[model samples]
Target: FALIHSRWTRRVTLLKRALSEIGIDPRRVHLEWISANEGAKFQRTVSWYVNEIKRLGPSPVAEVVDGQA
Candidate 1:
């Protein structure tokens, strides 16, 4: 479990870095360690993330694709 957690943490870090390099907000990425039984927690997390994305509006990458950047 320790090794798996360590590897996942590293991978998430890399993912955030890559997103930043591509003009995307790193906060747009979420990493959770919820177990399969945590249905309520999963639903709440997804709801929170959705609200956050709405608050942040569209991604810079999307504007670039639409030629508005």
Candidate 2:
């Protein structure tokens, strides 16, 4: 999740759209609003992201970087 301010919401949407246009899966990029004091929320969000990434296995970008593709 890209933790960002509510005011920057529009920018985040635009960024996701641009990334999608480049062939990247937008679902792999998440936009989440998290406040500075929201430690629990941050932990939960990171944990969820870790599990999701693990389920997806190795990233194609990393594979290409390591010449494993």
Q: Best candidate, TM-score-wise?
A: 1
Specify the poorest-scoring 10-residue window by lDDT in model 2.
Answer: 1-10
Backbone atom clashes (below 3 Å) for every candidate: 0, 0
Cα lDDT of model 1 by residue, 1-69, tens digit: 989999999999999999999778899988889899999999999999999999989888787889997
Per-model TM-score versus the true fold: 0.81, 0.65
| RMSD per model, one decimal | 1.6, 4.2
Residue 45 alpha-carbon offset, candidate 2, angstroms: 0.5
lDDT of 1: 0.91
Q: How far does residue 21 in candidate 2 sit from its true spot (Å)?
A: 5.3
lDDT of 2: 0.76
Q: What stretches of model 1 exceed 4 Å from their correct place?
A: none
lDDT, candidate 2, 1-69, per-residue tens: 445465478777888798789766556677676789999999999999888878777676777789987
